[model samples]
Target: MKKADLEAYRQRLMLLRARLCGDVSALAKSALHGAAEQGGAASSMPIHMAELGSEAFEQEFNLSVMETEEDAISSIDAALRRIEEETFGTCTGCEGTIPKMRLNAIPYAPMCVRCAEQEEAH
Candidate 1:
């Protein structure tokens, strides 16, 4: 890719990172509020079946969101470091050139599709 394209991807990565961080933070705050309103760890046992279901759903949803946000943050950080080291868009596992189209779709990707699928398979 051209230098300009790399810079553009960098900007996109930064924006994605910022957004993910904000989302994770917000989810964490919401979880904390919910936990607090339940009156501490001693009161974790829901008084009613409905209350249990709601809390379980919210906790599971927040956990999923947090996991996704964490992955995004890690990917963005790795991409930024690669950009600095002049290796952005290169597959970390196989050192292959990542297609520009893929990079455009996922600016923080650290591996090409083939390498990524292979890695996941193992």
Candidate 2:
């Protein structure tokens, strides 16, 4: 990849990493604390059993989203490393040049579409 393009992607990935880090922190706080953190809606005594269930579900959902965001952050980190190594747009699987359209859509993609599909199939 060109030096200028690599720098641009690096900047974008850094911004994404920063944003996702904040998201993960927020999700962790909300998931771990639940209603207690949200304006003291929680009490020493539990509310309704159904509300407890809902809180559990919400915590689980937040944790799930955090995991997804964490994975994306990892990918962004790997992409930044690849950029530093001068292999940003190259497919790690097939060693082909990944298309610009694909890169534009997913700047942190490690492989081309075909390789990605194959990887997913396995």
Candidate 3:
């Protein structure tokens, strides 16, 4: 990759990392506050079976979202490391240059389209 392209990817990756970090922090705080409120309300009031089921479902959904966000953060961190190592935009799976379009779409992607599809096929 050219120096300019690498620098651009670095900047984009940094911005993405910052945004993901902020989002994860906010979601964590919100989840904690929500759980606390729900717990207090449940203790003070006679909650019906349906309400309990719904709250449980909501908590599960939030947990899933947090897990997904955490995975993204991990990917972003790895991509940042790749940039530092001067391997950004190179597919780890195939040792090929990942297309610019794919990089533009997913700056944290570790593999090219072909390798990603093959991995998914397994």
Candidate 4:
């Protein structure tokens, strides 16, 4: 990759990392608060069993979403490390040059399109 393109990718990866971090932090805070509220005296007093079920379902859904966000943050962190190592835009699966378009679409992509497709096929 050209110097300019590499720099751009670095910047993009940094921004993505920042955004994912913020999202993860917000999700954690929301989950904590929700848990605390559910553990309060009113919650302990309890209402309808159906209402309790709904709250449980909502908490599980929020936790699932938080897990997804955490995964994204991990990917972004790896991408940033690759940038620092001067290995950004190189496919890990094939060691080929990853297209700039693909990088733009997914700044944390670790494989080129062909390798990604092949992996999916298997």
Candidate 5:
């Protein structure tokens, strides 16, 4: 890959990381607020059943998104490492040059299309 293109991807990754971090912070804050309300001395858990259920649902959704964001963040970091090592465009599974289009589509992809398909099939 060209140096310019790699730099562009790195910038994009940084942006994505920032956005994910913001989402994680917001989610954590919201979860804490829910807990605080429930754990309050004057609060009655049984009377707040509906509110608790909604909070639980929101927390579950946020946790799921946080997990996905973490994975993407890790992959982006790995891609940056590969760029530093001059192996950014090579497939880890098959030692093949990953297609340029695939790299453009998914900047963090670590495998070529063929190897990715094979893995998915299995």
Candidate 6:
């Protein structure tokens, strides 16, 4: 890849990392500490069992999304390291050049479309 392209990707990746980090932190706060801790009215005890179940489900959903965001953060970190090591825009699975479109859509993608599809098939 060209030096300018590499730098641009680095910047995009950094921005994405920052955004996801903020999302993960907020998710952690909401998921781990109930809404009361986040400036909401203290309603730790639900008046009905169904409300308690709904709250549990919401917390679990937040945790699941938080985990996915954390995984994206890890991938972004790896992509940044790859940039520093001069290996950006190359597929880790096949060492093939990842198209600019894919990179533009997903700056931290580590595989080409073909390889990614194949991996998904398996």
On lDDT, the leading prediction is 6
Q: What lDDT tens digits, residue by residue, belong to model 5 across residues 22-119?
A: 88788778877767876876744546678768878987887788788888888988988998898988999999899888887898899998899999
**Predicted candidate 1 versus true structure: per-residue lDDT over 1-122, tens digit per residue:** 67998899889988888888999999999988887877777556688889878997998899898998898899789899999999987889899899989998888888999999988999
Superposing every Cα of model 3 onto the true structure, what RMSD results? 1.8
- For model 4, what is the error of residue 119's alpha carbon versus the real structure, in angstroms, after optimal superposition? 2.2
Residues 4-114, candidate 4: write the lDDT tens digits: 887888887778778877877887888788788877778364488997788778778878987897898788889888888989889999899999889889989999999
- Model 3 stretches astray by more than 4 angstroms: 41-46
Model 2 TM-score (2 dp): 0.90
* Tens digit of per-residue lDDT, candidate 2, span 21-102: 9999999887767656544644554568887677778888998999999999999999999998999999999999999899
Per-model lDDT: 0.87, 0.88, 0.86, 0.84, 0.84, 0.90
Worst 10 residues of 1 by lDDT: 37-46
Query: After superposition on all CA atoms, how large is the RMSD of candidate 2?
Result: 2.6
Q: Candidate 6 — what's its lDDT?
A: 0.90
lDDT of 4: 0.84
Candidate 4 RMSD to the real structure: 1.8
TM-score, every prediction: 0.88, 0.90, 0.88, 0.87, 0.84, 0.90
| Sliding window of 10 residues with minimal summed lDDT for model 3 | 38-47
Q: In model 5, how large is the Cα lDDT of residue 50?
A: 84
What local lDDT score does residue 38 receive in model 4, on the 0 to 100 scale? 77
Q: What residue pairs are clashing in model 3? A: none
User: Which regions of candidate 6 fall more than 4 Å away from where they truly are?
Assistant: 35-43
